[model samples]
Target: MNIHIIWDEANLPIIKSNLSNVIDVIDDTIAVSFDTWLFSSNGEFVIEFYHDGQTIIGLK
Candidate 1:
């Protein structure tokens, strides 16, 4: 499994402290959108987000 995180740099401490429960941190933030991407053996996956948003995630 792969885990991805996109959040404000200022929250590094909080995020680091909760690595085991990172999803909770993202859930607590006020973000524009949250999404996921899945790829097949021959396919490519990508994650896109607006920089102005509070948090972004591309869980694959």
Candidate 2:
């Protein structure tokens, strides 16, 4: 299953939990939650997105 692709809305919370816990500002919604933060362990910055029970994480 592609995380970027939107699916059932019921999975939103689960997806968000998997990608949760970061120093990022997020505007959460039923369809999608968007956030961005830097990984303190390695200074590896990331942009995290959760939508409809799917998760997409990107590094920068």
Clashing pairs in 2: 11-53
Worst 10 residues of 1 by lDDT: 35-44
Q: lDDT (CA) for every model shown?
A: 0.36, 0.34
Top candidate when judged by lDDT against the true structure: 1
Misplaced by over 4 Å in model 1 are: 13-46, 51-60
Q: Model 1: per-residue lDDT, tens digit, 1-60?
A: 233444345434322223335346544542523432222223233234444543333344
Give candidate 1's TM-score: 0.24
The residue-by-residue lDDT of candidate 2 on 1-60, one tens digit each, is 112222234554333222243223234333242332222234344343443345455555
- Model 2 lDDT, residue 1, Cα: 12
Q: Cα deviation of 5 in candidate 1 (Å)?
A: 0.8
TM-score of each: 0.24, 0.23
